[model samples]
Target: MGKKISFVSSKNRGITLDMLVVKDFFRVNDEKVEFKDVVANENAKNSLVKKGNISIRKEYCKNNTDIICVDGSIAGKLSKNAPEGKRVLIATPYDYQFKAINEYDKGAFKKKNTYKNFTHIIVGSPFEKELLKKCYNTPKSEIIDQVCIPYSWRLNQEEFKKKHYDKYCKHYPMLKGKKILAILLTGELDEDEENPYAEVNWNKIFDNLDEDWIILTNSGKLLENMTHIGYQHRNQFVYSNRTFDTREVLSFADCLVTNSGLYATYFAVRQKPIYCLKYTNCEFEKYMKRKFSNLYIKNVEDIDMTKFSEFTSENEKFCEYFSYDCGENPSAKISEIFE
Candidate 1:
């Protein structure tokens, strides 16, 4: 008998990488699983696999495949169109235009009901599991939380740190000697969706910076004329509009600040000092507070540079809630069922 899984994603690289992490886990467990990469509604001769940079074709989903994932984008449409298989979803709901649970005004009910097609749904948090149950009416049993993602398997931490150091030396050579303050910004998904953090006046936020700031953004675009000019160029503020390698940036960061999103969950797993840039009424805020209450920052003015120097109770709490115990592989648990 052959075990096969077909991973499908529309275009988001992040989701595709998530699928790759899952693929890596299965291979490590000695599972006889053949993986296919399917790009919906497009054709490419060959593509570089996100993990290990192996090259492969954009293959079509084959019959007898056990699972079909509508990763990140095009969940409703692709899931409906996919062939008869065990459908799965890898999603992080943000209550936006591309939200897993959409708004009622524009076919939210119809869209959410489509989730019943999946045999399982993978999420990052306990809060998401409850949200899915409450909002999408998904069965509790189908939502699985395997918090120990195979990120290290995808890219080793040492390699990530080396790349970070190389990038720093080449691009932002001025940023040295000062403590690194990493702020993760949101990526572009839907243009029409209102951003809750838009109310934040960035100029006011960065006016009196306490440390050397590194803006880690998805899009490679930063504010113009924002360069610092002084004799102490060694501790200047800089930004990278590039898609962040989370572990690499975190390896050298003295403090971490981000909005409540997938990256916040990633940060929680590291058991490091974290400062959450609060977004009112955002679904992620609720989840972050539930899992990382001690890390929650209520005010932008209250972001303390000194907090990074010490450990907090939240670090232990975060690990307890979000991290897998030592020598315990949640991926192996998932493979036992999914494979």
Candidate 2:
């Protein structure tokens, strides 16, 4: 009966400690939180209650009407379960990886949380609601596409660049200057039954970029012309080297590089010149077209340094669906939500 809420586990507690414990939602509700209706792996369920973090079993979630979801499917499921007065909210960041419709891929059921439909949906813009509509297909009356993300509080993207942008610049042997090209790259799931990655070697692409680049990755050995940075270290085009908090790396980036698709969330942070393409022999590119801001670069010659900035600045399409806002971001907005 308290401000108790239910959450769907990302991967049976596969979510890193940093993702949940360090996120804005968790931080905001520090003492005013309780997870009674929890949905997660047995290990996660046990761990939370054993640690006294949650109050009951995750299955308790099925019967409870009070719930909100960080993902779409869960929101739909909860909406189907709630009583007439009870409701659900969608609090996750949105993008191409998330569909406008409920898509249960091979592993989707495990993460599904929504029941019928949410009473009200929260989003960053009408654009986000439009994307959600692509999935939920509900009338506009049920959705609330509000600017709720708080990117300002996270860290400065510019600071991130200053801290490590030049660390190995000379050593990496790439051209450098304020007019730099930083590309953050990601890909959609591999669907090719015969060949994955389409034999398109990434090293081949990075080798040809006549500009300084940092390939951020959680793993894959320290890369050259690329920053093999981790998730927390990732945000805008740059951030304060002294701190992980994000500022304006995106909007200010001269050139941005990424292999990420809409499934990845870094793009939601700030706007910068961005370069991305679909993985060969996959439906990823088809989905990327939904955003319409990405460039499909097939060869080294197709890579245009000048256009990187152009893409980031022009990509206002994604601005709509992102909601999982962070930063010193929206302290006022957040207070109002709880108010």
Best by lDDT, which number? Answer: 1
Tens-digit lDDT string for candidate 2 (239-288): 22223211223433454444443323344545434455543323334444
The Cα local distance difference test for each model comes to 0.51, 0.40
| TM per prediction | 0.61, 0.55
Candidate 1 Cα misplacement greater than 4 A, ranges: 11-15, 26-32, 41-64, 68-88, 91-111, 152-179, 188-225, 243-252, 278-303, 307-327
Least well predicted 10-residue stretch by lDDT in candidate 1 = 51-60
Could you give candidate 1's per-residue lDDT for residues 102-135 as a string of tens digits? Answer: 3332345443553554667765555455556655
Task: Give lDDT: candidate 1, residue 184.
Answer: 60
Q: Backbone collision count in every prediction?
A: 1, 65
Best by TM-score: 1
